[model samples]
Target: MIETIVFDIGETITRDDRYWASWADWLGVPRHTLSALVGAVVAQGLDNAEAIRLVRPGIDVASEYRAREAAGRGEQLDESDLYDDVRPALTALRKAGVRVVVAGNQTARMGDLMRDLDLPADVVLTSGEWGVAKPQPEFFARVLEVAQAAPEATLYVGDHPANDIFPAKAAGLRTAHIRRGPWGHLWADDPEVVAAADWRVESLTQLARIVSA
Candidate 1:
């Protein structure tokens, strides 16, 4: 039985529209331009942040991030950012005796924002807090450590195949490929994704049923 279910943040639980829109505004570009650039880099298997570098060559993204915070326009999150199914699905899982965890490639501030939302998760963690991001064996190792469960009994759910499905599966955790984000939709039909994912779900509600079965 799947005793624990771990989730990715962007697109899997929350839509990233506001996040990207804020970046585009800060960079003084039209929202659609940055959105297109993000999709282009993602399609080319490059990091999404590459879009910023593409817009302004040789710019230090970290420094700009700090600048934005100093300007009072840093990362922001609220219940509005969450997907419609997030609360119901996570609550269902927890009530069903499953441990629901929210861990993702997000900033430490994002972690704080997520916890403030009061989602029905047993734990909320982020790459910034952990000092390790996904697709890294060490990150998944931390996940297993926090789960305190056998790898086979823990399910890792995310939208990215490369970062979430492949690596989590390699770490011996059951992987669920959620088809909602840019990466998710792009790779959903790929043969490799199909092979790596133990389950493919369009919504978290489906995941509730999956674990129940």
Candidate 2:
């Protein structure tokens, strides 16, 4: 039985299309360009930092959008909406005795985004706050400790294979791949990642089904 469900915010719980579209517009590149680049970065098995490093020199990282995010003054664009049914679905899960935790690579400052969306998770975890990035066993371990869940009893759902699936599996948590949000289509070659996941859910609703059932 899955006693807890830990979520990643950006591309997992929230749709990142607006943010990426804004980023693409600011960078003067096509939206798919951002998608393709991120796909390649993840496929290369680079962690978030290394992938950002590799992509930075190729693009202007100090542009207005990223500048705002860096300064902690960035306001989310339209891409920050919760999945259409995610909140109510999660609410149902909470009612069903599953604890929910938010784990992501954001900053505590990102609490603003969650607040704005009126989504209050039971507990929030971020790489910025934890000083660790995903695909690292310690990251998931920290979340597990906070949720008081055994690794096998927790289900981690996120969009990135390396960040979400890899480390969660490494840490002994069941994993779910959110297959409808940003960077969703990039995990094509190594289908095994999603294939091996406990659930390959196309939307949050599907995930709720897996969790609540």
Candidate 3:
């Protein structure tokens, strides 16, 4: 039985509309342009942040992030950013005695913002806090450490195939490929993703039921 369920933040628990839109405004480019570029990079298996670099070559993204914060426009997260199934599904899992954790590739500030939202998770962590990002063996090692459970007893859920499904599976956790965002939809039917994911779900509600059973 699965004792712990770890989630990816972007496109898994939350919609990334505001994130890309904010970057578009900051870069003075049309939102659709950046969105298209993000999708392009995601398809090509490049980092999504490459979209920003495409617009401004040699730009220091971290510096720009600080600049945006200094100008009073940084990362923002609230109720609307969450998927409709997030609260109910996570709450249900926790109530059912399943350990729920939210760990994703996000900044330290984003982790604080996530905590402020008070989602029903036992732990909320970000890559920025752990100093390691996904697809890395160290990141999954940290997750297993926090979980305090055998890898086979934990499940990792996310929308990205390369970052979420593949590595998590390699770490011995059962993997669920959630279909929602650009990468989710684009790679949902890919042979590798389908083969790697132990479960393929469209929504967290479906995931909740799968776990409960």
Candidate 4:
């Protein structure tokens, strides 16, 4: 009888690996280094947006990659090229009477990111706009209010452990962890992963079934 769903946008709904490849190119650093940095920061309890802000200012990591792409010399890239079935999946969930809301730590270009990808989101909550990021119960609180959903009736799905799992559980919402590759070892290993979630799946399509069930 789940009536609402909260989703983390980047990896859970859309493909984020290609975006990270772009970020690695733009920053002029190896993708592994960026992955390590992000993992370390999140391991220390910083959300994704703050971690990027903290690291980007001090180092010129991949900053030039975007300019090269704009000049048509870098890797073939476009947000449009990376879309999945998330939009249609969400539309179906809404038609089935589930309220869908998106929450993330989109830092500077939240609007541009969504526009560039044509992602379908009912409501977008970003750390840059909210001054708070995920893993904090308050972030989930705000989204629940916006979606007019009771915590007992809601479920949250995301890719990260700390940001998505712990807080949503603390807020009394069921959680689904989407397991994918390309993230560094900064994440918890198997035990934590197994312990933190109510359900775990490999893709949002599986999540569609969970909600309907």
Candidate 5:
């Protein structure tokens, strides 16, 4: 039985189209250009951070983030940003006695944005507070520790195959590849990679139906 469901924040539960769009605007690139570049980076199995550096040479992420924060220019996630299936799916799982958590590679500052959405997660955590981010063994290891869950019993739901699916599986967790977002649909044609997933769910509603959670 799946005892816990670990969620990916952006593009998984939260529709971050506006978020990335804003990033493209700030970086002076077409939104689609930035989007395609991110996908290309993933397709090549390259690190997103390095890709960002390569795409826009000398772009200072931290400085841009700080400037946006000071100017209140960053697009904030609202309740409407939640996907249509997010609430119903998570609610069903929680009602079924599943432990739901929001664990992502975001900062503690992003926690405020998550709270604004009023998501139905039992616990919300981030890399900033945890001091570790995804794709790192310590990140997954620590999450299991906090939930007191055996990796074998945990189910991780995410969009990115490499960052989320592969790493979660590496840590001994079952993974569900939700094919709605970019990374999810990005690798759809790659049968070998997609087939490795324990489940391929197009909608959170479908996932709720199949999962014991």
Candidate 6:
């Protein structure tokens, strides 16, 4: 039985489009331009950082972060940032005796933000907390450790085919590709990749139905 579920937070449970708009605002570009740029990056399997740099030449990624820190202007994650289906799906899973876990490539600050939001999950973890990031084997290993879960009995849900589905499958967990995120939508036509997923859902609510079925 799949009693444990490890979820990638961004674009999976979190509504990240707002942040994409925030980035466009910061870069002084129309929101749709950044949206199309991100779609192109994912479609080409290119690094999104490079796309950002191209959009804003002379962008000092680190320096910009420090400037934002100095300004105390960080994009905050709150309940408002969650997808419409997140709570309902998590509640359904929890009521079914499943242990839901948030495991993702996120900054350490995200851990606290999630905690403050009181998500309907048993435990929350992040790349910064684990000192590792996904697509890296160690990150999944650590999540399994914390959950005390057998990989085969765990379901890993995320939005990226490369970063989430492929890596989780390699780690021996069932993989679910959520169809809403950039990479998931852009990469959906790759039969080789999509065929490998144990499950796919248009929305988290659909995930609830899948799990129940």
Cα-based TM-score, every candidate: 0.99, 0.78, 0.98, 0.72, 0.89, 0.92
What would the per-residue lDDT of candidate 4 be over residues 9-127, giving only the tens digit for each residue? Answer: 66665565666666666666788777777666666756544445554676433455446657765543345544366777777888788887877766435535554554555676666
Error of 3 at 171 (Å): 0.7
Native-to-model Cα distance after best TM-score fit, residue 44 in candidate 5, in Å:
2.9
Question: Taking the candidates one at a time, how many backbone clashes does each contain?
Answer: 0, 0, 0, 7, 0, 0
Candidate 6 lDDT, 6-61, residue by residue in tens: 88988898877776787787778999998888877777888666667779888987
Better of 3 and 5 by lDDT: 3
Q: RMSD of model 1, in Å?
A: 0.6
What is each predicted model's overall lDDT from 0 to 1?
A: 0.94, 0.71, 0.94, 0.68, 0.79, 0.82
Better TM-score candidate (2, 4): 2
Q: Which candidate is the best by TM-score?
A: 1
TM-score for model 5?
A: 0.89
- Which regions of candidate 4 fall more than 4 Å away from where they truly are? 30-83, 115-118, 183-189
What residue pairs are clashing in model 4? Answer: 26-62, 26-63, 26-65, 27-61, 27-62, 27-63, 28-62
Per-model RMSD to reference: 0.6, 3.6, 0.9, 5.0, 2.2, 1.7
Per-residue lDDT of model 3, residues 130-163, tens digit only: 9999989899999998887799999999999889
Point out the higher-scoring one by lDDT: 3 or 6: 3
How far does residue 189 in candidate 2 sit from its true spot (Å)?
7.8
Ranked by TM-score, the better of candidates 1 and 2 is 1
Off by over 4 Å in 3: none
Q: Can you write out model 2's per-residue Cα lDDT over 101-174, one digit (the tens) per residue?
A: 88887766665556555563677667777888676778887888877888888998888877788778888889
How would you encode candidate 5's per-residue C-alpha lDDT over 15-39 as one tens digit per residue? 8678777788877788888877777
Q: What does candidate 4 score on TM?
A: 0.72
